[model samples]
Target: MLKRIWTIFIRDLTVNMREFMTLYMIIIPLVLAVGINFLSPSINDTSVNLALIENENPEQAAYFDDFANVELFSDEQKVEDRVMSRDSVAGILPKDNGYYIMTQGNEPESVLEYAKLLNVLYEADVQLEDARSEIIEFGRTVPPLKKMLVNMLLLLISMLAGMLIAMNILEEKVDQTVSAINVTPTSRSAFILGKSLTGMAVALFSSIACLLITGFYNVNLGQAALVVFSSTILSLLIGFIQGLNSDDVMEAAGSVKLMFLPMAGSIAGYEFVTGNWQIFFYWSPFYWAYKANDMILSKSGTWPQLILFIGIILAICGAVYALLAPRIARKLQ
Candidate 1:
């Protein structure tokens, strides 16, 4: 039975490789991962921008470089040019052993004040060790934007798994091979499992590749994979139902794509809706998956929390499967 399932999976993989859409689904996640990596800012990156004449005061320029985004200019005119440009940049010009803060006047008051404060501290020769402030750590290293984007990408890849299944099923139907499944030695159960393998493989492969490409190497892959695996249940069910009912791959894929509506709602609800309003998203497996993925990516996920999320996802998927099973069976016949 395992061998038969493997053979079916291999055949489906070969067929999917020959199709452009299937290849696009497989490659798109990695491409998006690169984009996300390039766009997402690091956790330590600051929003403050400062322009300095390095030759005028190298000491101040070096000090400010450690705190803000400092741009060095050869003279005061260049510094003024940079500060007056579109971007908000505060210029500190040296005059008679004192410093002058230069801005476009339209720049934010907070930025002007921050530049003044930094100059005041420098003039006072303030030392970090003298302050003796103790720092507390929460151990969260990944930026929130990057974490959210990666989680969304993972969810997308999981749904694409079901789409792959739908495409494979459509191919079989188009070739008039689905009707002959029973006549062959392969059971319906084996055929279903065989068809699912490619989707699962693609989902898992794309997910891992995305994580690695997006600089999530430190994330707990085992915990992340569990969330991804559990979330695929609803999509796979939808894929099978749509694939069985539709006349072509595009129709089946279109129906499967409709699953994104609830997914987007769930993510938005979980992230934005607070207090009692969050209950509205509990029905979606994606909400749980997002929670689990967020915890995992942030390195705060516990085994118990992961298990609870996975259980909820399975429960939701199971309910959906129970409701759709009869329809899928009829279509299969």
Candidate 2:
């Protein structure tokens, strides 16, 4: 049966090669989103046309340097006018000891976007200063700041790969291939493995290729690889299962939007984007994947933690597959 499934896997590849649809489903993403992510310009220019106030202190000015392109304006009104005219992205104005971020919009609201970042940086500088003073200069290496980088990877990974797997399966279903293979004696287990392998192969290959092209970033090799692969396969399998549940290709593709929020939100913890506990995220495979990825990328986790992270996802995938196999078999009957 395993041999047969392997043969079927090869057959799937041949069929995939011959079909422009399958090729398009996988190749288009690689050439587009993933390609663009690596090729796009960096956001290094945090500089903004910022205007400071009369009561500005050196401490505040230091903060602005971290997040904005600081340009001084004499009055808050001038800053407001520039913002209203769309001449500037944001403006910093003075109030008392601190300043207020005045933004110009039809709603006449304040956009502390850049200002808030500056404030955070300034506060960080102050905290660091205090720490330095307190430590009596206790020699310590500053930990590498890996920003919400982990979240971005998880969001991109699960969504992209999940959408692909789901869409591909939905396409196969729409084409009546799922119905065609319903009569196979090798069982639904074999059939699913065959399809799962197809999607996994695409995701795994694309991920590795993308990483290779961009050059590896701040991630531990063995731990990260294991975590990423496990999570990716689980995500792909879940996506495939969801795609199979769809009645048609368009329906399946549209379903990707439904999965987006959960997948992206689930990774919020990986990047610490929101302190709000997304309870729904607990159920998302991508969340676990993101958590696991965080360990590898940050190199802050122990071996047991890494194992549990990767291992649990694999177990979940196995469980989901087992549960699905019986249902698929009954449907075949």
TM-score, one value per model: 0.86, 0.58
* Candidate 1 clash pair list: none
lDDT (Cα, tens digit) per residue for candidate 2, span 236-316: 655766686888666766766576676666655445655466454666667777776655545567999888767777887
21: Cα error in model 1, Å: 0.9
Residue pairs clashing in model 2 are 47-69, 48-68, 48-69
Candidate 1 lDDT, 144-245, residue by residue in tens: 899899999999998998998888888877888878887889988898888888888888888988999988888888787888888987788888888888
Which segments of candidate 2 are over 4 A away from where they belong? 17-21, 28-155, 175-185, 273-280, 315-325
What lDDT score goes with residue 260 in model 1? 95
Q: CA lDDT of each candidate?
A: 0.87, 0.60
* Candidate 2 CA-lDDT value: 0.60
True-vs-predicted CA distance for residue 97, candidate 2, Å: 27
Tell me how many clashing residue pairs each candidate has. Answer: 0, 3
